[model samples]
Target: MAVQANFENIASYLQQFSHDRSIPPLEKWNPDYCGEMDLVIKANGEWWHEGRPIRRQKMVDLFAKILWKEQDDYFLKTPVEKIKIQVEDAPLLISAVDQVEIDGKQYLQMTTQNQDVFVIDAEHPIYMRAFDGEMRPYVKVRYELEALVQRNVFYHLVNYGELYDEPNCTCLKLHSGDAQFTLCM
Candidate 1:
């Protein structure tokens, strides 16, 4: 069937980059732009193609692994091709958060909808970005990619935040590992 063939092609293309379940080296790939793909990542974190939602979790995970952001555009990159895709907001969403303590230090661990888990640290700092006239929380996920923290998750994060007085205003500060993030300026 056409679907099976397409899936096999994608799997084969991805096989060379699969080692220890790490992300593919997208920065090393200099593929030519192959134009647009009929794919869209909705603001609500839904992945759609050709007017229908992509219902397979494995397929979505595979696509997420190939996602790359260049300047203001998003693309799915392979060794030989780079295809643009639409992203309404961020390409991913932070769906869950957990507070973990180690050696008397607390760390916030966030999980994306794609099941990617990362600790909020210096490398993965959270920041506020204006979205729809309101400042929302976003965190750096990987190279040039960010994940918008969902409303409920943001609220959960707020529970662990503290109000710190700055020279100009009061700021909500959240800590994870040795890094501190300001939710607002």
Candidate 2:
């Protein structure tokens, strides 16, 4: 199928699943690879198509819902088709962070650029990885997909972290609910 026709079909087919905030069951979807799309998610969290930035927030949000990852590649999947896309860094970006208390327990909540919110816990723990020669923080969003914690959000999160002295090195420890993450280990 041509790229434009396929793109419109995918968008229209996915519209039904976009009404609510729940994510589509991409894991259960087994579609044939429909070649590649000229879609590139840049390291800075901008979605570009062809050579121009995709300025439509709604379209970006809809596409984010269908994002799937296999091995090291990313794809936009529908019920019948899957198109590979390029990702310079992590597919999503953690745009904001907040510390919320519930029943006297603290939890770190992260919001992605697409407005997907998740708590930092065992299910979505933050980890350090080397990106562009610097160790940066990332949190798992869902289905093996991760969001690169923005630098400003990372700094804001640091305020809620405490210093811990490991046996070999000192690390920054962040506690959220029952999960504890040690950074710079």
Candidate 3:
């Protein structure tokens, strides 16, 4: 199938980047934009190149690490080059979640497809958006990139929510690492 072939190609290409947990300092890189590429990350988290789907999970993981956003545009950046790419929605997807309590404070952590861990705290707040025709949740990742919190994960997150009344509206607030977030209004 074309999908499988694309995956193989992607896997080979990913070896160029090497698998490292540390994200490259893309913000510090001042590379010139080398025009647009035929790469696209679908809303469902599928990566495509030249209109073909990249089915390899490893390749997707590699690309996720180097992804960045400026203003409203998305790009794949490295120390030497920057290539513009298209993202149908959030650049990353929160595929799993874990919660822990530290000193009576609750901390919520999310794991992305590439195994990047992020704490849902003041520095990384969660937001909800209406996409297509339904409400989808998102969380700030590094720099200007955001990860879409998956449906099942959202359901799990609601278990810790508490209702809070404000001057104009009542919202479901949740806590993670001593940081409180408004889940819904």
Candidate 4:
């Protein structure tokens, strides 16, 4: 049975929430930023890649797939997936995001809070109307983007389009207008 909740005035409320919310600025960005990636070295002690370091656009595509390869299990670390939000009835899947790792070490971050101030369910309506900066919920997903947000290493939606061009891995549009994802090469 579907209950009719009055979401008639929710869109305006959501807009205010989006406009006031903020996150730390990305230090740098990569169009092809993949986390904890491995680069092979030759017997001759020369630097080498599994394949030649591809063109920038190609690298971005590859990075997205690598992260999404084990989408569910990857986030198993902090376990951010258990979510019930006011956004939709379906539970949101929050994944662990390891920004980048080099020499077997990388930085990792997990999603914490993803709330929807719309439709008014579990909070005070007065609180909903309240616009205090301190009380606003950081409702979007946050990844440990140790890599710069403006780099060309991965397919950054800020610069390029989707992260896959060959073999067709699974791709996803992230919460950010300038961010998207893919799974497996």
Go through the candidates in order and give the C-alpha RMSD of each one to the true structure.
Answer: 3.6, 1.9, 4.3, 23.5
Candidate 4 local lDDT, 126-184, one digit each (tens)? 01111233221112223421111111222332232234345543332232222223322
TM-score list, all predictions: 0.84, 0.92, 0.84, 0.19
Model 1, 1-185: lDDT tens digits are: 24334445565787665543467888999988777767899988899887899998767777788899999999988887777889999998999999999778999999988788989998888998887787778999998799999999988887889977888766789989788888765
Q: Score candidate 2 by TM-score against the native.
A: 0.92
Could you give candidate 3's per-residue lDDT for residues 1-185 as a string of tens digits? 24344434434555776657777677788877666777899999888888989787877788787788999999877665567889998888898888887787779988988788978887789987788887778999898888998888877777777777888765668888768888663
* Predicted model with the maximum lDDT: 2
lDDT of each prediction vs. the true structure?
A: 0.84, 0.91, 0.79, 0.24
lDDT per residue for candidate 2 within 127-169, as digits (tens), equals: 9998899888899999899999999998898799987687886
Q: Rank the candidates by lDDT, best first.
A: 2, 1, 3, 4
Candidate 3: clashing pairs of residues: none
Worst 10 residues of 1 by lDDT: 1-10
Which one is best on TM-score?
2
Candidate 4 off by > 4 Å: 1-5, 22-90, 100-106, 111-185
The candidate 2 region of ten consecutive residues with least summed lDDT is: 163-172
**Model 2: runs farther than 4 Å from truth?**
164-170
